[model samples]
Target chain A: MSELFDPLLAPYDERRRAELVAAYMAVEHAAAPVPEVRFPALREPALRRTVAAMLALSGRTLVRGADRDWTSGYHDDVAAALAADPACVLPVEDRAVLTLVLVHSVAIPRATGTLGEDTWLSPYPAAADELRRRSQLPVGELEAALRRLRTAGLVTQVKAGGDEAGGYVPGPQFHRLTPGARRRLQEELILAAGPDSPLAAAIRARRRSNEEAS
Target chain B: MSDEWAPGILARARARVTGAVSVPAAEPVPPGLAAVPDGPRTWLLPSWPDGATPAVLEQYELAPMPLDRSGQARRVLAAALRCCWANLDDAPWPGVPAPVPAVLDVYAGMTRGDAALAGRWATGELRRLADTGWLVLDEARGVVRTGPRTALWPHEALGPLRDLLRRMPGPSREALGDE
Candidate 1:
């Protein structure tokens, strides 16, 4: 089939174009970051630029992995702007559930020094029973919300194992967030989970300074 | 950077995160969307590169979006296809709207005993399928139509689906009497 030449993709040959498209599709659609070793095309600087251009067309940004991987997700600024319009944001109940998960799975662990990384992925799964106790939502409503979150890749269920009753953790979709988005999420978690903490104060101070600088 | 294509690309990208965006009937369908045959609006189905799918995640032991009951969901989708898709030769988007009961009947037919129970299970599965865009459920109209995602099924795979659907029973004639 004769393909229309997209100026953005013209730098690459047909095979390269195919590789770029495949890599983009895999990144956007996959629940997790695609390992760079398997998709060598992502390693090429020119091809990576092409992918970024393609992503820009749609208001997305390329998520370069800290580990060897690649993915694409909403550009943080664009997403925040969109979220200002209520329709574009997650519903209030869903946000509540997500915040609970983040607090239990991420913030609490980090505060206790059990978790080392700033990434959303948490080894300390939030126990369902604990969530039930902490949540203001009714059990049925909370369960239903969790189910929706699970389906959307916002949270994943962990199976019970020796010495640990399985619960929930941040899902693969978290890996798709760009670095800016990840930092923003971390800051948001800190503010929500530890509003009075010295760390939250520091974050607020930094944000204020950055805003003044801008 | 081209001014003309920016809005279209933005619309397609937003639709990827959100659901299908509706285009005016008189307006051209955006670049990424494939127009639904004889349907009111176009639906965006991302064109995947050859031999790549969301399943690529499996190679790295990553699970795709969790489907609550995949087996039941697929069975419900097959039943929706059986009901809505009238022509074997054509692609299955914008297929004829089949009454909700009719699709449920076909689903119930797939299992032995307790048709009512099967129908209940099928109803739940139908909602889940509708939620994921595999089928469009029109509750007020009491009908179900094949959704845009069905268009993603590759042409080569349709032949096997055709054979399987052929052997699978259709909605009993008595059930269709009301429609």
Candidate 2:
């Protein structure tokens, strides 16, 4: 049984172990990124590594947010591996709806130079009316898919307020994505939304070079 | 537990986050999940560390995943629990399956018999609960059972839920067609 113990976590007492586990749970379960200050256990390098190891035992990665917070999410490679099984992926309709929202909320604004952030979250929500107009799916199917997406935390509905008509924005789940996953999503969006752009060409070139190097 | 098992474990873990993953009952359970064995197949339900639940998001004024008509859905779930969870000593999952009408009857009892509109709403909520894995609705048999998620409810949290369930009135006799 002693041999089963992880050396990193073995240094901590039972109470301290519980605290670290609690911190991991807090980050893993929370809908949004948890502030680092809220859990002092996470600040210790050893405890942080232990938590990362624990997360890895189940195929998760601890995501360090730009805002000095923490969350847990799947690594891009693991997700890609899982994508080989069709049952593991989002349904095509759901994927289509999500792509449209991303294009409208993130890609379009970035292309027009109105959004400056490198992250997926955007203040500019994609309106339902516009999505309906743009989608090839029937209005009923689109509406149903949007409902499912909202419930799953992939897209959130914004109430109509002050100068802004209510619409949908990428939800808190985006915050759970690791940096690599976020960067890959950005590249995919660029490729899909502006395939003719020089940035897309550069992305294709980089992918080719990386493949050759590997 | 060699390094070779890592990819398969990771894929199952990722798949489980959004939906239930069924594995062979004879297989060893994955790291973060609790197995609910059902004959030859086992459903993997993700387990969280003690004292931490998704409700923690509310403490920071952050919304958890959105639920459509959450109140109605929860009430319907409660009704199902009241009907299926006959033995208070046992955990909620793998509870006795109850007929849909029986669950609906209990739901109606909870709401003081606003039967027509309430019945429709309850039916819709039941379907939604089934979709989200809160309840398993066997449409062909018209039976409902608690889903694996209920088993994840912390033991301490069950006390209050048990009390609330105890105080809840059972299915109305007239609603059950007994003169």
Candidate 3:
């Protein structure tokens, strides 16, 4: 079974670094880091628009709701955003997984990463488990995915085995979608997503609704 | 006033605009693309190009307007603007704040301080001046220059700036800078 691991997601670590810098500035500006915030707490949870645009460049757009069914409008908007952007990296599926991981994290951002484990991680423990469960496929599909990411130079293996979150946390520098990285992702997103695909249609419909409401 | 105080004038204009527009603030802050900086202010900020409103403007400086017209004056200006803009055709709209006479063609919609713009330019009537092509908004230079058509020599062909609001859907960006 092909492995599902993605090494390319490591650049997200760089993003975390940049965000930390911004957060530190905001906290300093606010006179404090909102002491209530802790290593286990989410400092900033909203998917910033610019960051969202950046992630879109990675070939995946964050699904803005709790629903599981992906929409075409979402894909279209994500594609459009990426098309306009030159940043981001990772193939389509990897970007999708990365986006989903980040999106779901909004519900609980403190659980994984440099922030360390927190209550935020607990709520979505199921996600990691799902990855693990899927990891058992005979040919190591998950492993294969991770290999592809490594070959693309997006991920680096630090160690084997999954964490308590049941997800493999790659090295610290694999999560960001650098400018040129995104172009590669855009192509993958379109290829895996397919033109006229149901996912694309739904994304388009969602965008239409949003535009109409505005 | 010397254009050297253009810096001060820019600040004054900003304060007036901030007071005029309703900015939608949310968790993810909306993008403020134009980072026009305040003259003496430390922060390097940009004005919302063509998007300035009196409300946003109040943040910078509140210069008392030269006119004494009251609320009713707005209606007069609106009427005049409608007459002048009535004939303009729809064009590309960048969502930028173009002047009424230039592209927006609706003078009444563009307000300056408490008094309707009519008095600011010493134009006897807002509707009258705008319709005759007497208004020119120099947003970049931070000034509104009124021509002589309405006073020195009226343009007989120029009509009131009404019927032009219909063209607002897609106004050309040039109007904002087309002089």
Highest lDDT against the true fold, candidate: 2
The i-RMS of every model, in angstroms, reads 4.1, 4.9, 23.9
Model 1: residue A184 alpha-carbon error in angstroms: 1.1
What lDDT score belongs to each candidate, Candidate 1 first? 0.76, 0.78, 0.33
- Give the alpha carbon lDDT tens digit for every residue of A1-214 in model 1: 0121266666677789877776777777776677778775688887777777767767677887778888888777567656675646677888898888888898889878888665788988999988898888999989889887887889988989999889999887888777778788888987987799999999999999999999
Q: Report the error of model 1 at residue A183, Å.
A: 1.3
Once fitted onto the true fold, the runs of candidate 1 whose alpha carbons sit more than 4 angstroms away are A1-5, B1-6, B37-40, B44-63, B111-118, B152-154
lDDT of 2 by residue, A1-214 (tens): 1122245457778888766766777777777777778776678777787888767666677988878788888766666666776767778999999999999988889879998757888889999888998889999899889987887889989889889988899988898888788888999988988899999999999999999999
Candidate 2: lDDT of B93?
Answer: 77
Q: Tell me how candidate 1 scores on lDDT.
A: 0.76
lDDT of 3: 0.33
The CAPRI class of candidate 2 is: acceptable
True lDDT of residue B137, candidate 3: 38
Worst 10 residues of 1 chain A by lDDT: A1-10
User: B1-179, model 1: which lDDT tens digit per residue?
Assistant: 33343566556555666664445566676664555533565655544444356655665565466666777788889989999997878988778899888898888877788888888889978877787678888889889998877777768768988888888888887777653
Looking at model 1, residue A25 earns an lDDT score of 70
**TM-score of every candidate relative to the true structure:** 0.87, 0.88, 0.20
Give me the displacement of residue B141 in model 2, in angstroms: 1.4
Candidate achieving higher DockQ, 1 or 2: 1
Candidate 1 CAPRI level:
acceptable
Tens-digit lDDT track of model 3 for B1-179: 12132232333223222221112232221233222211232121222212222232233232212232345444443433333333333211111233444422333245456444443443434433333333433445443333222222113223333234454343244544553
For each prediction in turn, the share of the native Cα contacts (below 8 Å between chains A and B) that it retains comes to 0.33, 0.32, 0.00
